[model samples]
Target: MDVSRTRVLQLIARPDFPEPYERLAGGSVWLAEDVERWITEHQPWKADQEAEEEP
Candidate 1:
């Protein structure tokens, strides 16, 4: 997500973010597609940037 760890923690804490897929002993896990969808919807500019970054 190109965000600082602290910022990612904050984003995931938001009510609109997707519910985590699982909670491991280490940390929570989320489906990439779910997060990608959320980013595409809420951060379209980021989605565009990511798409441009890919080969």
Candidate 2:
């Protein structure tokens, strides 16, 4: 979650990224679960310990 706004915008621009769940006055919002799945697929190194932490 330490990602920068520019990086997030870049991700959002990708065609494969999940669609925004809502479009508020300020910006768009996507579900965390969807984002996490996308991140896991794109970033395996970061998820090395994720399986152990899951319930």
Best by TM-score: 1
Off by over 4 Å in 1: none
lDDT of 1 by residue, 1-55 (tens): 3689999899998999999999999999999999999999999999999999999
Off by over 4 Å in 2: 49-55
| 1-55 per-residue lDDT for model 2 (tens digits) | 3779899889899999999999999899899899888878987666766766668
Task: Name the lDDT value of residue 43 in candidate 2.
Answer: 76
What 10-residue stretch in candidate 2 is worst by lDDT?
44-53
The best candidate by lDDT is: 1
Residue 43 displacement in candidate 1 (angstroms):
0.5
Clashes of 2: 0
